[model samples]
Target chain A: MLKRLAEVLRGMGHRIIDRIWRLGSGARFFLYTLIYSGESFRRIHLTIREIYFTGVMSLLIILVSAFFVGMVLALQGYNTLQKYGSSEAIGVLVALSLVRELGPVVTALLFAGRAGTAITAEIGLMKTTEQLSAMEMMAVSPIARVVAPRFWAGVVSMPLLAALFSMVGVLGGYLVAVPVIGVDNGAFWSQMQANVDFQADIVNGVIKSVVFGVACTMIALFEGFDAPPTAEGVSRATTRTVVNSSLAVLGLDFILTSFMIVT
Target chain B: MERTTMDLWVGIFAVAGAAALFGLALKVGNLTSSSVGDTYTVTAAFENIGGLKPRAPVKSAGVVVGRVDNIQFDSKTFEAKVTLKVDKRYPFPKDTFANIYTAGLLGEQYVGLEAGGDEQPLKDGDKISHTQDAVVLEKMISQFLYNKASESDDSKKAE
Candidate 1:
């Protein structure tokens, strides 16, 4: 019986390896399709819709959350700084923390949870329903039609959304510091302005957001395309997409920070 | 196909608009107040640097004139020694005083300098004679509250 169990386990391992190899090959095919395509107009349209949905549509929530985050940072920073009587540096601390780290990362994770899950589930459902197969049968490349649009959308939307998040967060910090925490508005903005450098923090944030967007879209599309042909499979794919995308965003953030240090 | 063409144009416009806005915001932020470019080096001796870090701004008269470049311990003095980059244009007189000041109620600490004297200018690598260490706010507040409560207790006993 033990010998039989060992044999089964070995078989399962072989199957898993074979499955991973197949998935890798499929990914390569998708990459080739993207590279060979000349459908610039189609890609642009897809990207625009993605920006509208992922950025414009999600603006309200991102702004609200950023505002609160900024305010809390300022309040907390102010409380601590008041001890040594250098309360004016609150702006610099808030701006640096938000622009350099928190703003882009938090916004990307939020986007992954919302748009990333939706795209995965939508694609998975279409696959299970035979819509994707029907498109292929009709000589339409699903790679260009489905995957390209979502990929471009994520790439286009991420930077815009991240910028908005940072702005709102700064404003939030300003409100908290000036009114609630009793720091002067001029002092707050002045300190922030004095410390923040556009090249180092802002540009770095935008670059990070773009990379995050690409990772999120790719993970979602991959999970959706590989879903099992069942109702349960679509649900599982959606769950996996969100989990994977969130983890990927965090992982990429660390890698990007390390890379930024070197560059 | 026609819709795709229009969308393409729209995407271009949107990207351009976002980029323009971001540029404008950055310009405005820079215009209102900007970092000091002049750099001078000053050293301070501290019993404890605490969590002080590099890239921390060094300010004079509530305006940043430089940054903390490095921190190390002096074996002979048994104190943490900090190296500062002050703007070269902002002349530090011979008797300038440096103190570690915290921002807001819970913010990061920075080195604050008070310019002193009408005599000789401080040269590069000159040590600031006086240094006030970081005063942690929470500890002070708690102490103040404790003292207030004890005073109230004394008054109640006398009554």
Candidate 2:
């Protein structure tokens, strides 16, 4: 049994190494494709469509969720601060935490799970049905026709969605503070405005969103293109796209934060 | 089939709108320092700084008049020297006192300045004479728990 366990461990290690190799090669290929492409305008157009669908459409949900998130944060923060006789700093805490970290990261993860999966499934289905092949035969570049638009869309939509999330979150916090937490509305907004810097929170939120957009688009596209031509394959690809894109968004957020902090 | 100019215009509008909104948000947030006015500085010394960091607000009578700019340790006194930037309009007397207070149970610290009624206005680089150290929540909770345990032990001994 011990010998069997050792063999399994060795096999797992090799499989992990092989997976890493494939991921590295895949990333290189993607970079090459992007750099070598002459038809970036076409991708930009597709990106607009993605922004409209992913960003504008998702605005209401993001706003609602952010509002509640802000409210909860304010309520919890107020309670804690009140104990220390410093309930007034609730605005600063909510604004900073929401804009700096939660706003863009949470919105991007939601987008990845929702729209990213849809893009992968749609493209995977097209590939399996040979629609992509037909487009190629008809003198349309599959990369230009399909991938460019989706990629651009992801890029454009993410920042806008994040902004919406931040705004809604602040408003939500306001609602909780004034009505439930018993903080005066004017005091709440004034404190928030005083404490929060537009450049640090808003700009950072948008920048993170843009990065998330690119990450989500790339992960979805990669999964779709590499999917095996089977029904189960398409389903698996969609699942992988969502999970991988969400993880990538979080990882990228950390890297971006480190860079932002240093520079 | 070719796409119409109208389609291109619509796409441009969408992107432009998103960018415009982002720009507006930046403006509203005042993230740009260009809008900020002249800053004035004051100094305070604390025995224990706790979690007091730079950018913590300096409040006078529950209204923020300035922010903590920097914190450094004085090796001779074993205390923290915190510098604050107050608005030009707000003046502090030379005998003012600064206290480090927690804003919540989570123990986010801020500087509270109690203005003195002394005849002379505090000039720049003047140090506030009286300072109170921060009272952290964790320390208070631990102390409470220790007392409770000791009291329980005493009751058992009495029994």
Candidate 3:
């Protein structure tokens, strides 16, 4: 019984040690990616191509989701705000929530599932097919040619996507509130403008999106790079990318929010 | 996809994203309205500034002419020192009354600058002395209750 208990403890210790070792390597990989990013910028075409894949391709889903989210927010906010005879304030509600929290967060979550997963799978597959090995053998740093461009693309795309989300979301709310719900159109726009500060709300949301972009892209890159060169491994890494990116976005959001609120 | 097509899509996406950000700033946020140009900083001290926060609008005759820039407690004087940044164009007189007022029934608190009949305009770093504290709802309610109670007591005594 004591030996069995000792074995359990040993297993736990092994996991903890392995996690720490992986974290250390991930940090090193991130550093390498950053160092190699100069090549991606110099090439410009590589990063632009990645942006087309990551940013332009993801626009449709982001816009659709943002619209629905806004409409839902208006529907729900009107329900509660009407109790206080302040249904006009629904504009403030939707804009504030979307700009301050939902826009960055939802965009990041969706980006992780969409672009992040694609990035992981693509990289993992490249590894599985010995493409990465071939590139290395050719004396080319794959980090510069492949990873850095994708990383920079993600970082650029996230804030823009988040901004688009917020803009579309406000329009969605306006649609539902004004025409559908019979709210005054002027009040909807004016109230939103009155309450939402550019520096405090919109700028902060952009900052959050930038941070999420860095975290999500790096997490996906690390997972793909670390995955074993196998079919099952690649699939697992893709799954892990989504899961870890989401958790990281949420956790970082809380920390960032705390810091922002104090400021 | 072709490189040209990809480039075109990315270009469109970048422009759209930038436009969205600009739309958000102009249409959905108070960026345009809140840009009071070339501000002159002035200070006001209040005995109580209930819920008066930084960036709260400073309106003159219901038109926002400035903003509250800072709020600090003066331990020595037991007053809240509020620093305001008013637009240079809309200068206030030295004897202007800075009264804290609520916008609506339950809206945010802001400072109302009631210009006074003074010859000299207030300059930067100047202090406005005639300031009114924010109206505390609890104090108002209690005062109303006390007045009602006293009136009832007077009626009973008369009876």
TM-score of each: 0.66, 0.71, 0.85
Q: What digit string (tens of lDDT, one per residue) describes model 2 on residues A1-263?
A: 99999999999999999899869966974674475355757455555555566666666677788888998999899989787776777877787888888888888888887788888888899999999999989988787777776676677677767776776777788778888778867656655665676666667777888888888878888888888989999999999988888888888888999988787
Worst 10 contiguous positions by lDDT, candidate 3 chain A: A186-195
Model 1 residue A72 distance off true place after TM-score fit, in angstroms:
2.4
Task: Evaluate all candidate structures by whole-model CA lDDT and list the values in order.
Answer: 0.78, 0.77, 0.94
Error of 3 at A109 (Å): 0.5
- Model 2 chain A is weakest, by summed lDDT over 10 consecutive residues, at A42-51
Q: How many Å off is the CA of A242 in candidate 2? A: 2.4
True-vs-predicted CA distance for residue A73, candidate 2, Å: 4.4
Q: Per model, how many backbone clashes are there?
A: 23, 8, 0
Model 3 agreement with the true structure over B37-130: per-residue lDDT tens digits: 7899999999999999887889999887988989999999999999999998898899999999987767778999999999999999999999
Write candidate 1's Cα lDDT for B122-149 as tens digits. Answer: 8898988888878866677999999999
Model 1, residue A6: what's the lDDT? 98
What is the TM-score (0 to 1) of chain A in model 3? 0.99
Top candidate, metric TM-score: 3
Can you rank all candidates by lDDT, best first?
3, 1, 2
